[model samples]
Target: MIRAARILFKATLWFVVLSVLWVGLYALVPPPFTLTMAGDLFQGRSITKDWTPLADIDPDMPRAAIAGEDARFCLHHGFDWRAIAGAAARNAQGRRIRGGSTISQQTAKNAFLWQGGGYLRKALEAWFTTLIELIWGKRRIMEVYLNLAETGIGTYGVEAGSIRYFDHSAARLTPTEAGRIAAVLPLPKKRAAIDPRGFVRRHGNAIAARVGVVRRQGLDACLK
Candidate 1:
């Protein structure tokens, strides 16, 4: 029993040390690829990605993303309690299991955790989200999230999405174009940002309006 306890303690210590070092390293350097990217490659899906700095990406891209995914992104410190509470209440009423994950949480999941819904994944995502909020700050968190998010089936990042969908550089995307990209974020594989129609078109328009609102209200001032 004592020997088993010693092994468990040593394993726990190593896990903590490694996790800290990993997060610290990523806080400084951009990750070359994510687990999702690797999984796609392993599954024989052609991955298309171009890593672009936040400065190189159009300013509207981040605004649209924040507007669509997490309106209170800059206000929260990794988690948005109000959104969580609302989602929980809705779920308890037998509604769809919509998530209230903020951009920070999404970044943590995309960068470190695998794609899926589970308690263990949520716990790890929460831990990494807190670490990033403490170390990477709002700007870096948005930067990483923009670059790592799956924009389409086998397409990753704004750069790739821009080139594939709009035939333009990410830095040159207009607000409408950026909004369209943001619109498909929830179900990228099933939506197209270039020639959005029906629901996507309307949703993209809404996100574009919210982008303006966020800009005027300084909702993302923390990134500045």
Candidate 2:
């Protein structure tokens, strides 16, 4: 039993060290690929992505993301307890399941982990989220999230999604365009940013409107 405990301790120590190094390296470098990207490739899907720096991408894009996804992105460290409580209460009502994960958490999951939910995954996500919040900061977190998030089926990143949907670069996305892209982010495989209908269209429009609010209220202050 003592030998087994010692082995486990060594393994955990190595894990912490390696994970720290990985996070540190990614702070200075864009992650080359993620597990989700590999999953798409294995399924015979053609991946489309372009890693545009946050400065090169339009400011509206992040604003739209913050408005539509996490309004408290700038205010929180890595988690928002109020959002979590709200999501939990809503979930208890038996509606569509919602997650209270902040943009930082999403970045950690996309950059270093896989999709889907499990207790183990959630715990790991929390760990990485803390590391990123401390090491990567908000600006880096937003940058990585925009670059790594799946914006459409077989498409990753705002730059690729922008070109595919609007035939233009992300650097010049209009508010409407950015909001539409952000709307499709939550369910990229099922939604279309261009010519969206029903909920997607409404959500996109709402997000577009909130883009102005995000800017006015400085909700995206962290990025600056």
Candidate 3:
């Protein structure tokens, strides 16, 4: 029993160390690389990695993002405990399906972590999420999200997604088009902004509906 206890303690210690190290690294580094992507490369996969400041980005980008990724983004510093608790309870009752990771959490996972949906990855995600919240402010987090989000397998960032989906820059995306882009974030591969299918249309409508809600509720309310 004593030996088992020692092994467990060592494991716990190692995880804690790794968590601290990752957060410290995030605070120090800008972004390890312009692109930390995975999977097979494809045509038209080049990244336009201009370090545009947060202000340069369209307000609708973060607006829709907050609406889609974490409606409570402005209210939460980083983690949304209510959503996390709900996800935990839901996952516990079943085969452990879905998570309540916020936009900040997803950003950390995308930028610094891997793609696996494992418990280990989730724990690491939470650690990095907290790190990003503490190290980077709301503006920095949104800026990073715009740059790192995967619109396609090899394509990344709002600019890339905009170009790929609509053959235009993210700066030029219209409200209707932006809603379409935001709708498929959950299942990007299965949906597209240009798809004539009813599913895409329906999703666009749903996103459009929430656009006003997000605006009227005030963008900052999502931070909690």
Best by TM-score: 2
Largest lDDT belongs to which candidate? Answer: 2
Comparing 2 with 3 on TM-score, the higher-scoring candidate is 2
Model 2 C-alpha RMSD vs. true structure (Å) is 0.6
Ordered from best to worst lDDT, the candidate numbers read: 2, 1, 3
lDDT per model, in order?
0.91, 0.96, 0.71
**Candidate 1 residues 5-48, lDDT tens each?**
99999998997788888888988899888999988899899999
lDDT of 2 by residue, 110-211 (tens): 999999999998999999999999999999999999999999988999999999999999999999999999999999999999999999999999999999
Deviation in angstroms for 113 in model 3?
Answer: 0.5
lDDT of 3 at 217: 75
- Per-residue accuracy of model 3 over 137-217 as CA lDDT, tens digit each: 676788787777766555567777787778877776666677777776766656777763787788676766677778777
TM-score of 3: 0.76
Least accurate stretch of 10 residues (summed lDDT) in model 2? 98-107
lDDT for position 106 in model 1: 95
* Each prediction's TM-score versus the true structure: 0.95, 0.99, 0.76
* Runs with alpha carbons beyond 4 Å of true place in candidate 2: none
